[model samples]
Target chain A: MVGGGQLARMTHEAGIPLGIRFKLLSDTPQDSAAQVVNDVVVGDYRDLDTLREFARGCDVITFDHEHVPTEHLRALEADGIPVRPGPDALVHAHDKGVMRARLDAIGVPCPRHRIVSDPADAVAFAAEAGGFPVILKTVRGGYDGKGVWVVRSEDEAAEPFRAGVPVLAEEKVDFVRELAANVVRSPSGQAVSYPVVESQQVNGVCDTVIAPAPNLPEELAGQAQELALRIAEELGVVGHLAVELFETADGRILVNELAMRPHNSGHWTQDGAMTSQFANHVRAVLDLPLGDPRPRVKWTVMANVLGGDYPDMYQGYLHCMARDPQLKIHMYGKDVKPGRKVGHVNTYGDDLDDVRERARHAADYLRGTITE
Target chain B: MVGGGQLARMTHEAGIPLGIRFKLLSDTPQDSAAQVVNDVVVGDYRDLDTLREFARGCDVITFDHEHVPTEHLRALEADGIPVRPGPDALVHAHDKGVMRARLDAIGVPCPRHRIVSDPADAVAFAAEAGGFPVILKTVRGGYDGKGVWVVRSEDEAAEPFRAGVPVLAEEKVDFVRELAANVVRSPSGQAVSYPVVESQQVNGVCDTVIAPAPNLPEELAGQAQELALRIAEELGVVGHLAVELFETADGRILVNELAMRPHNSGHWTQDGAMTSQFANHVRAVLDLPLGDPRPRVKWTVMANVLGGDYPDMYQGYLHCMARDPQLKIHMYGKDVKPGRKVGHVNTYGDDLDDVRERARHAADYLRGTITE
Candidate 1:
């Protein structure tokens, strides 16, 4: 396992009962899961010797984060360490430039884009792709709404590009909603897709995800799932693949980005689906047969807990538990920061509205904006 | 945590993401979960000082097993540590005599029984309850299939009871099937009951559980659940309460026994119910509102991997995973022995028969009998 955040924490948790031991690699001594899992190798991911030591005695290597350099992964694989979804496939998820180029090559529809290494290139792309309010994104290592910005004027896009940052410029999409299509693929080429979810974003960070993408047409949902399935199979990824989608006003679905591991959008599956994305990720990487992706309930929703204003948002934990008895809160042991993905809550039932509202309410309570 | 075993292992696993710290009481440095959670205090449950050290700074005290003496638990409670369920309620589950007597006093119907400390008392009770074929059970410290005997003739029952064993002689139940009703109670008096499940016992040890008690009348299931709810409420238990039910040939439900924590019968809920029994137990003990007691699917079946002829069960784990993609196996970190509750596999789907067979097949495979 890599990273000691909640995702890794949950995976480690699930593996323990099955008698499958997991060793977590973390940078900080206080990494959430490391506090509980004793076999932790504490070191920065960028340190080659640290990574090498961490990979020792491991049958196969997997990750909780996609931040490791593709070259570093390649080095491990070259030394005969079995790294699932190998570096070549993982690069599409780690770097935006690589992802865009790969998706385009596969004829997957995406937002119009341009690679901008200089300020002039950004300005030129903005001029050609309809002037104001274009999006500028870093080519690598951005997550949780970070490393992306919007520019309304030519001057606004100049500094970021001129700083010698390799950026990607794309036409700002006027989509009706953001949908996430999640899938898991095994080393044996088997793949399964979860129902597309309608993701609600607040300030570029995901606030809530409603499974089955409420009110989405059957054909559109299938198309989105097919796109995710194609990516996982084509990339030969051996774990979860989360495809963020832009559901256009005209009902077309466009790919936004991809994550080659369990993604936040699939958190609802923890309580709602027959088998969770975390469990599937473990099986996929371990070369086990994939479990069913069909959900246990009719509707499921997941809401994230962003950084709260309080020092300890735990005060609401009790109230949230009391108010929404069915809500499943998964809090990541991390210092609360503005816009940080601290935790999430999952709620599922036949009533879509009830689940959605309950999930949001618990999330709001965690954020200290609402009280029971 | 009281003991560093599989239950504690999974609890620690669940607590990691929420940043909930636990102090495990271990007998050895590598007592399973202790191998993962290093923050364990090595000592026996019989030691008060060690217990105090483990209890201090803990948010809420719970257990991994019921072997901790009731007196020690009371002492912990006296010292202001919040021991869930408390001694007064836990005694019923810890001692069979106390449980039978308490159930009788509470007006819950059970088998005609009498406590015996000698051979004379057992012979008299058997004669009164219809001679011969009586069941002799030790009142305390019996689990799995141990410490129980079937006495067909008076002579067989005489010697065991003469040893001052403190036995219970009861009319053998002529039950059509055994069922388990699981309920969770909060400290604040709130409670929720899950659907009754039919338990399959092989040689006095539980081997399987079928959720919703297949084809059980709605009224009968509701009655069983109500009985469980009433018992949990009356007992003032602040956690899970698992009531084993004996469905007699005459279609009557009788209380067989009680367990004050997550039971094997409820394992199906992990992948089948609205809220997992473990999660609900956590919620109830923490005094949080109880989760819904709704089954997510139409059917769910759980089969135990008991101590059987299986010697190299680990070798079969891969095959089981590959064979049934929907089967969920939970193996405890214990050396498998004949008649031991080492692990379980749960499967759920729309078709009850298919799910049941899948669960049974996986369980048999783990037991070293992979016969088609």
Candidate 2:
């Protein structure tokens, strides 16, 4: 795996029981996955030579993030190392412009979007998209709400174009809620989709996810899954593909974005799904048969534990475990940095409200957002 | 962790999500836990200086096995490296004679037995118990039916003493089936117990385990749990204690043996129980609050995959996973050897027969004991 973030850390954990030997290419020894995985090469994923050195003797190459240059990945593939979700597929996740164009060409439902040449072009696209209030995003290298702006005027749109990368102007849909449909596919074409989940975000960063998307029409849930599976097939994705969607106020779903690796929206599956996304990603990258993706309970809620006033989340375990013995708390082994995603807490039971409260309480307590 | 094996491997995996850093003491790099844990000191655990070196920067010392010398544990404690299930408690698990005496004094029901000085003394005790057939065992270091014998004659009785260990003689009680009650306790005295499980052994090696021990009388199950908890307290054990019991033909349960760490009988908890034995064991060792130990389903069946003609179990995943998507397979990273436990499979649902069959089929298929 390239990149030693929490996703790689979790994927490595899932691989342990399967007897998989993990070799990681990380930026530093202190990286989340590097602290746990035995064989770690401290290097740059951006450098082609570093990537080639990392791929030697590895059965396949996968990622914790999609920041690796598309050309670097193609070179690795040419060197005979199997790069899952190969360069062609990964580009759809790495670049917003490419993703919007591909989804549109495939007749997939998506917000009105276009690659803008400059701030003037962005304003023109916004005008074409029905005037003000547009979402402007850098075509490449944006995550966790960074490099993204909600532009209400031409002056506000110039910031994105100034990043010196192609800017994508998209209509900001008035959606009732955000939902994610996570699917995993193998090289042999075996695929499995998890239940569509309702994702709640604060400041464009995910805060909580409710599995099965509460109050959703059953048919709509099935449609979201079919859409994700179709996307995976059309894109030739050979690992986890998280399709972020917008459930409009008018009762319609539109593609919001795509993530070709494990995403925050699927973290709830760690405790709730029969097979976690991390496990399925490992299986997919290895070209092994995928495991079941059914929810294990009636409801499961996951709330992100963002770093806050508390520097160490370990102190929260005492009260949290004592209060909710059934709660599953997963920490990223990263030092606490305020507002950073340090971990997540999962709660599940028959009652959705109770599960949600339990998850939220634990997450809040860990984040020091609540004391009691 | 002081030993490198599947137990250690699973424990390390459990600690991963908790962001717990693990340093292992192993005999070789190829050991199961050593392959995954980043910091592993290759040295003999029996050597006091090597152990002292390993314990230098550790938070606490724990084990994957009980072979670590009791005195060495005491020395580590003297060095201020807290050894969970401290030396005093570990001695009970290390030596059967001490365990029997302790249990008898505590009024815990166990088989009638005593230490025999010689073959004549064994025969005398056999005659005293109105039986020629009796069980003879080495007072210490017996596991998986090793160092134990069912002796029907004086010649057979003499074999155990020749090994130069004190022999413990006991009446061979005819039992209906084997069961195990697992419990975990923290140093602060917090304790949790998993549902008692029915264990099936072939050739004295665990073959299958059914969680909640189907058909067990409710009160009797509670009594077994209470007994196990009482034992953990009595011995001052600070980690997992698996009390092996015999459900006799007369409808009474008797203590058979005890293990101080994660045992085979509790393996079902990995997929069945809300808090796995491995996770709980880690929590207990770290002196953290214990998590819930409740069954997540109606029943879960676990079947061991012993090494047979199949050398690599990887080939079995496609067939097993395709046939039963819900099957949870956990494989130890070990080279296959005849009759060696290489992995296990867990299947769970509302149907007992279906669950058991699925687990058994996957395990057998993995072992190459069955095809199609």
Best by TM-score: 2
Clashing pairs in 1: B307-B339
What do the candidate models score in CA lDDT, each in turn? 0.83, 0.93
Query: Candidate 1 DockQ category?
Result: medium
Stretch of 10 with least lDDT, candidate 2 chain B? B124-133
| Residue B185 shift from truth in candidate 1, angstroms | 1.4
Candidate 2 C-alpha lDDT tens digits along B142-239:
88889899999998898999989999998898999999999999999999999999999999899999998999999889999999999999999998
After superposition, candidate 2 runs with Cα above 4 Å error: none
What is the per-residue lDDT of model 1 for residues B1-372, given as tens digits with 9 covering 90 to 100?
787776677667656545566678888766767767847888988788889888888878888777788999999999999999788999888888988998898899898888876766777888888987888888877776676777877668765554455898888889999999999999988888899999999888888899889888898898899999999988888888899999998889999888887788888887788677877887777777777778878899999887568655766767887787677888776677876777888888889889888888888878876654
Compute DockQ for each candidate against the true complex: 0.56, 0.83
Q: State the displacement of the C-alpha of residue B68, model 2, in Å, after optimal TM-score superposition.
A: 0.7
Task: Estimate the TM-score for candidate 1.
Answer: 0.94
**TM-scores of all predicted structures:** 0.94, 0.99
